[model samples]
Target: MSTEILEQEIALLRQENASLKQQIAASIAELNTTIAKLEQEISEHKQTEVVLKASQAELLAIFNAIQDVILILDFEGRYLKIAPSSAPSLYKPPVELLGKTMHEVLPAAFADYFLDGVHKVLKTRQIEKLEYSLPVGDREIWFEATVAPMSENTVVCVARDISDRQQIEAQLRHQTKDLEQTLQELKRTQAQMLQAEKMSSLGQLVAGVAHEINNPVNFIHGNLSHLEAHIQDLLHIIHLYPQQSLETEISDLDAEIDLEYIKDDLPKILSSMKVGTQRIRQIVLSLRNFSRMDEADFKAVDIHEGIDSTLMILQYRLKEKSERPAIQVVKNYGTLPLIECYPGQLNQVFMNILANAIDVLEQRIESKDAPLPTITISTSLVAEGWVKIAIADNGGGMPEDVQKKVFNPFFTTKPVGKGTGMGMSISYQIVTEKHRGKLECCSIVGEGTEFVIEIPIQQ
Candidate 1:
């Protein structure tokens, strides 16, 4: 029995030992799992720390790279912080401007503008914008500022330099103005060319007419003297014969023919014919002079001759028309040397101005019971080898606004189709661009208008 009990105790102890061994193994395995999880958690924590550090570095780099001057200000316009990149744009160094109030660092006007924007943004909780200019060093600097509320009592301000943009805008505006002026000049030139062509055709026609009339008029005028002498001789011969000696047939014929009346009227008729021929000759000469078709090139021409020719061309207009009385032209002639110029073009200028003056006078007469219209033309030699011709009219004058644009092409106060509006503009071009001269208009409303033309004596 003792031997059997020993065997069972031994078996039980072995069983207990086996169970404890199993429990120790399980505890060891659990401890190993816990250790591995803790190691994994440590590695993940380190990686997260590295990623956070890199993100912080990248954010700082972005802040430093910004070009705009970023600032934080309190409600009272005191600077709380300044961007690290603001050193170059600030009026002073960052060290000096960092904590200073805007009023302390900037001009009163500029500071007030910024403060106003800040107040507006803080009050409304909305972004506010401002544009201003300030003088820095030797140049003017322009800035556009944006202010937004960052908190209840703080605002973020961003300012950018816009001086270059302003300069570019100004340059563009200047170029646009120049382009407009160029376009207007081109149009004026085209109009002038067209007018010149028309005048050339008219001048050719006048020259041809004058040439054709000259020869026949000369022949008729030359024969009138001979014809008158021949008739006088025949009448003398007939008078020498006695009336009683004359045959009855001759006396009867004389009674039928009325010889006495013929003798009296024949002399008067011849005299009248001579006068008419002289007038025709003068008119032909005036027409030829006015046409100036033969004098196309620049030549030394008598200025008075040009003036007379222009007057003759416009004589019909100067005459008393049914609508108005005759326009009186008072010539204050001056002693002028022969000027070297294009005679035809110069005559055209004279015609335009004189025609305009005549039109003004005629319009005045139709409007009211005005005085007898008068045009006064004065010529004088000025300094610098220049000759001045002043044409003045005693008619209602243009207003200041009209006077200002009187020489602009296509600008007219006359009724359409009545005035081409290119007359004065062409005259201006002729005097200034073609001849290198000056033309000016002086007038007072209700008083009179005067056009002063100055040109050099020699080309």
Candidate 2:
């Protein structure tokens, strides 16, 4: 019985040991599976870490590449993170600016402005664009900032220095002003050349006409004296023959021919011819003075002579026409010194002013009983050794606005074909710019217009 019991116990023991070995083997397989799975998860985690590091490095690279003064701040204007920047206009360096409230690092006024901007961004939930200035050390620097919401409580500001752009704009403005001034000078010069050419041509024409008329006048004048002397001799001979000595045929011929009447009329005709010739000679001389063919250069000349000569040249226009009465000229001449000036140019100024005055008078549309069309010219040496010549017309005056722009180029109040707008403009330049003078216009509606020209008497 004891031997059977021992065998059964050994069998039971063997069964238990085999069962335990199988369980242990299962446990080892499960442990190996768990270890393999854990190893795969570790590898995946390492790959994710690598990807995160690459993303972080890329973000940092982009932030630095933008090269703006970037700031991350909370709504209270406290700096949260400051990006490294290469800009030179920062109020404070990145190292010092980080972790600082705006009030602690900036002026109180500017700090308040910045905090308001941040609040505005949060309330509107939109990007804010603004400009500001900061004093670095000695100079103020301009900055442009772009602020955008970064989180519920924070904002990001990207600022750039715009001082260089502003400087370029200012330079452009200065250059434009210089160009405009140069253009005006060029225009004035061109006007002077054109007017000078016209005056020269006119002078040549007048000189030619004067020379032509003078030749015939001289021939006729010289012959009149000789012809008169010969006729007187003949008349003396006839009178000496006596009526008593006349034959019947000669007396009858005298009765038929009226010889006595012819004798009486002949002397009076000769006397009138002499007077006419003298008037012709005087007109020719005036013409010569006016053309000034030999007086083109600057020299001391009688200002009154210039004015009178110009008036003489314009006499035809001043004469009475069938349509209107003659325009009267009243001259109040004051004693003046011989003014040193370009005589021809001064004459041209006179011509322009007088011509304009005549035009105004001729174009009078007033009632027939209106004041007689008169131009009053006054000359005087005002207090500074200056010659003042005022030409005024009692014709229709210009409006205040027209008077203001009267001296501007291409401004005219006449019909296109009758007037070249450059006349008054050139006259102004001749007086003011060339001769260092002042030309002023005074006028009142329905009253009269006067142009006052003041110039130094000496060069």
Candidate 3:
């Protein structure tokens, strides 16, 4: 029984050994599988890390190379990173802006808006663009700023200074205004030429018509003397038998009973007809003289006559009591030689200058309480074959600054609808360029202004 129990114990020990060996083998197999799985996971993780590193390097390079002023800000509007290109030349390096609130670093005035924009971008993740001028150091600089959300709690702002472009834009605007002014001046000049041409044509037509009319008018006047003599003889014969022969002659004529009255009124009718015909002749002569259609060259002309004719043309302005400043004209005539010029053009110059003088004189009278404003026109032959015409007026004179700009195109001191500044410019071009004359102004602040026109007669 002892031997049998020993054998059974040995068998039990053998089974236990086999079971322990199987458990060891199973454990080893499980360990090997776990090691292979871990190695595969490690390889995948290393590949992902390499890809992430390369993306990070590329992103850093891109951020640094941007030309715009790029900055990273926290949700609270604090600066986290500033691109190197964003720093101004005079400013410290971009690192100095890091880890500081925008409000704490920038000035209070500029900080508020910048911080507001940054926070907005952070909250909405939406891009915002703004343009404003910022004071950098002492001077102001214009910037076009753009803010964009980079992450859930961060913002990236980019700014570009566009002050130079703005200055160029302003310059362009000024040049455009100047060009427009030049174009308007050109138009006015063209119109004035057309008007002068039309007037010349009309003057010639009127002069020819007046001359033809004068011949017929003279014919009627020439017949008047013969008609008067015939009528006088007839009347004297009728008077030979006035009261008694009047009834007898009426019976002899069978129907004419008013021979006495006919004899009485016949002389008056002939005399009136002669006077009327003579008056018609005189009007035709005056029209011929005024138009001067036959002559347009450098001819001998009485300067005072030209002055009087122009004054006559503007007489309506003088006579109308309702016109402003009720102007008073004082003429100071002098003996002057005939100026060698186109009488019509010279007449135009005289008319334009005189009109301007009257206008300015009226304006002065309306503006201030000056006693009886006067425009004194004086003409004299100066030395060196020249003629000096001076038109002086006791009116409001132009200021120095305004005087400087008077010759400029489209510069008018008169309000809109009252005057176009083109009058004097056109007149200037006419006298100085067309006629080769000199026009100069002499003025005092409160006294008045005088315009002196000097032109060589013999040239």
Candidate 4:
């Protein structure tokens, strides 16, 4: 019985050992599969770690390359993280800034501004910008900050130095101011030149007027003496009519006085005196019109009337002289409506242009092969609600380069004392700025020169 029991127990123990081995082998296989899966997960985790490190390096490199100071701030304007930077706009070092609030490092005003900006970024969830100047030791450095929301209560601030740009804008403003002053001074100088030119023209006008008046006065004086003699002879005849031999005395007196001659000459003297008075009246009218002091402001006026007045004022220069023939003026006027303009200024423009034309024509008179000195003025309604007035001269034409700058300030082709060079420039300003018109010049080398003025008929 003992041997049988021991053998059965041994056999059962063997079978149990075999089943335990099978279970153990299955557990070992499961453990090996789990170990392989764990190893694979570990390898994947290591690769992710490398990729995360690379991303951090790239971000750090990007931050380092930028000149802006990158800072992380809380909603309360506390400096949480400050990127490593060498920017001079930073008021303090990164060590002193981290973990400290802006109120602790900056002035109350700057701290308030920063806190407000951060709150605004958080509220709007959008980027906000602020510009400030910091006193980094002695000098002030300007910075432009861009604050963007990073989280619910955190903001990222990127501040860039803008001192150089601010300085450049300030310099530009100063230069602009200087240029304005210079322009005002130039305008003042031009005004003085214009006044001087006006005085010179007035002098010439006075001389011409005096000469014209003197001739008429001398003729009137001589004619008055002849009229007085004739009247005395007639009076003598009338007084002798009371005498007894009145018929014979009247007949003798009539023969001695040459009554028919007196009758013929009296009307002529009266007619000539009337003509002189009319001429003087015309001259006065022309002067009054040319000066146009009453018309200082804008008014509707006849263009031809102004042109004619200006021509009369400058008539002395156009007369035939000993050295040259008279410069002929040809007017090609078309049907034009009344133009609204400053009459006085327009006359001044006409005077300047005509004077210059006459002078040029006079100079060219010496050339044997030169064309007849002619100043042709043409007026017309060139377009709807606009008028054109062209003044041209068949004289020595100007070059293209000279014509380009003809309207520039202080540029003149005449001798130093002869011209102030501001005439055309001022005229251009008057036509363009005051009247809102255009003044242009066109010329050919050997042909002629023309100045065309186009102005709106209405204002």
211, model 4: CA deviation in Å?
Answer: 4.4
Tens digits of lDDT, candidate 4, 203-297: 76687677666677788888899989988987898799789988888898899999899889889989998888888888889988888998778
- Candidate 4, after superposition: displacement of residue 76 in Å? 3.0
lDDT of candidates 1 onward, in order? 0.81, 0.81, 0.70, 0.88
> What is the TM-score (0 to 1) of candidate 4?
0.79
User: What are the per-residue Cα lDDT tens digits for candidate 1 across 105-191?
Assistant: 889988997888888899999998888887767778888888889999999988888889999999999999999999999978876
TM-score of 2: 0.53
| Model 4 vs truth, CA RMSD | 4.5
Q: Is candidate 3 or candidate 4 better by TM-score?
A: 4
Where does candidate 1 stray beyond 4 Å?
A: 1-193, 196-246, 366-369
| Residue 425 displacement (Å), model 1 | 0.9
lDDT of 2 by residue, 220-267 (tens): 677677667657655755775766745764676567656676677667
Q: What are the RMSD figures for all models against the true structure?
A: 21.7, 20.3, 22.2, 4.5
Best by lDDT: 4
Candidate 2: count of backbone clashes, pairs at least 3 residues apart or interchain: 0
For each candidate, give its TM-score against the true structure: 0.52, 0.53, 0.42, 0.79
CA lDDT, candidate 3, residue 39:
92
In Å, residue 328's CA in model 4 sits off its true spot by 2.2
Clash list (residue pairs), candidate 3: none
Error of 3 at 66 (Å): 31
